[model samples]
Target: MKTFSAKAEEVEHDWYVVDAEGKALGRLASEIAFRLRGKHKPEYTPHVDTGDYIVVVNAEKIGVTGNKEKDKMYHRHTGYIGSLKSVPLGKLRETHPERIIETAVKGMLPKNTLGRNMYKKMKVFVGPEHTHQAQQPKTLDI
Candidate 1:
């Protein structure tokens, strides 16, 4: 018996649409990361970009438990000294809802070039409307 390893050129990427309304942040992100990494496929190859494209909608309605809404802080630093900046999850939702899911899923992916390529396959929208209708993505229930 021989082990099967999928190749990048031989892999077929499928498009899937997910509704984020009322879904838990962490759980949803993990699921999205799973699909993005192509783990759901039988021919998954870790070294290859075998993930499928994911379209996430209703990002503004994603849910979080406990005090995460206010207590969970996202931090960033500027190039200049003393330029650290932070924002609460609640505030970030109001300003950039799409980033909420994006950040969560990003953290779950591999921290390398392969991960960045997989991350690019995900598309997030604040509302139900997305521009990927042309691809006829199937609805993915998480």
Candidate 2:
């Protein structure tokens, strides 16, 4: 018996589409994260980029339980002093709904170069329509 390690050139990437309408925010993010990391595949290799492209549609319709829309806050800071700023989920959704899913999935992925590479393959759309129809991505149920 021998252990198999996947190589970058040997890995195959596929495109998948997921509808976020009526789906729990956290659950959807986790599933997308898994697919992005290729953890569900048999040839998953931690050091290689084995993930597939995931197109997330209807990002504006994603759901969050309780009062998260108001309670959840996104924060950022400038290099200077007293430059911290925060935005609530509700405000963020109104301004950039796509960012909600992007931030969630980003938090679930590894904080490194490989993670950023995989994250680039994840496409998010505010509406049901996407521009990747040419890729013929299969529907991914979550």
Candidate 3:
């Protein structure tokens, strides 16, 4: 029997809704990344984008286990020297809660073009409301 390899055109993408309220950030991000990479599906193919769309809500309520809120720092660099900037997780949550989840999930995915394509399938929102209602996404419990 020939080994199965999923094709992009043959893959079916489903939309799933995840509630981030009161959930651990790392665990939630891992699950979301798993689905986004299509690892949960039997037809997963490494070269093809076989992931599903994930819509995450209530990002502001996501929990951290330890002092990550204060000690965990997000760093960025401007083009020039000595232009590095950092922000604590706590501040990021207050300013851009969605980014906390996005950053976590992004780190878990492959560092390639395929990974970037899969990452685009996710949508994160700060509150309980999302605009993907038209997709009729089913609730996905992590």
Candidate 4:
């Protein structure tokens, strides 16, 4: 038995849809991270990028437990002598709902090129409507 490695191949990929409405942010991100890393597939290869596409809908409705929405902060710097910026989770959700989920899942993934590739497969939308209807994505029960 050979273990699967993280490599890019020309195999067919499936598309899955997840509704983020009323779902916990961390829980949803874990499931998406699993699928994105191809852990749910029978032919899962640690060194191969065999993940499927994930569409997250209603991102604005995703919830965070406790007071994270207010206390949680995302920070970034502009590469300057004292250029630091931080945004609260609650504000980010209102301004950019998709980013909340994206950030959570991205953080849970491996920090490497393979992880970046997997991150690209995740598509998050603020509302229930999305432009990926042509792919015929199946609803994921997460």
By TM-score, the best candidate is 1
lDDT of 2 by residue, 80-135 (tens): 89999999999999999999999999999999999999999999999999999999
Predictions in order: lDDT: 0.96, 0.97, 0.95, 0.90
Q: State the TM-score for model 3.
A: 0.98
Instruction: For residues 24-139, write the lDDT of model 1, one tens digit per residue.
Output: 99999999999999999999998998989999999999999999999999998988999999999999999999998999999999999999999999999989999999999999
Model 2, position 31, has a per-residue lDDT of 96
State the lDDT of candidate 4 residue by residue for 1-142, as single tens digits: 8654544655457999999999998888998999998888877877788889999999999988899989999998999989999999999988998989989999999999989989999999989999999999999999
**TM-score, every prediction:** 0.98, 0.98, 0.98, 0.93
Residue 22, model 2: lDDT of 94
CA lDDT of 29 in candidate 1? 99
Which digits, one per residue and each the tens of the lDDT, describe model 3 over residues 1-142? 9999998899999999999999998899999999999999999898999999999999999999878989999999998999999999999988998999999999999999999999999999989999999999999988
TM-score of 1: 0.98
Ranking by lDDT: 2, 1, 3, 4
- Model 3 Cα displacement at 41 (Å)? 0.7
Off by over 4 Å in 3: none
Taking every candidate in turn, the Cα RMSD to the unseen true structure, in Å, is 0.6, 0.7, 0.7, 1.7
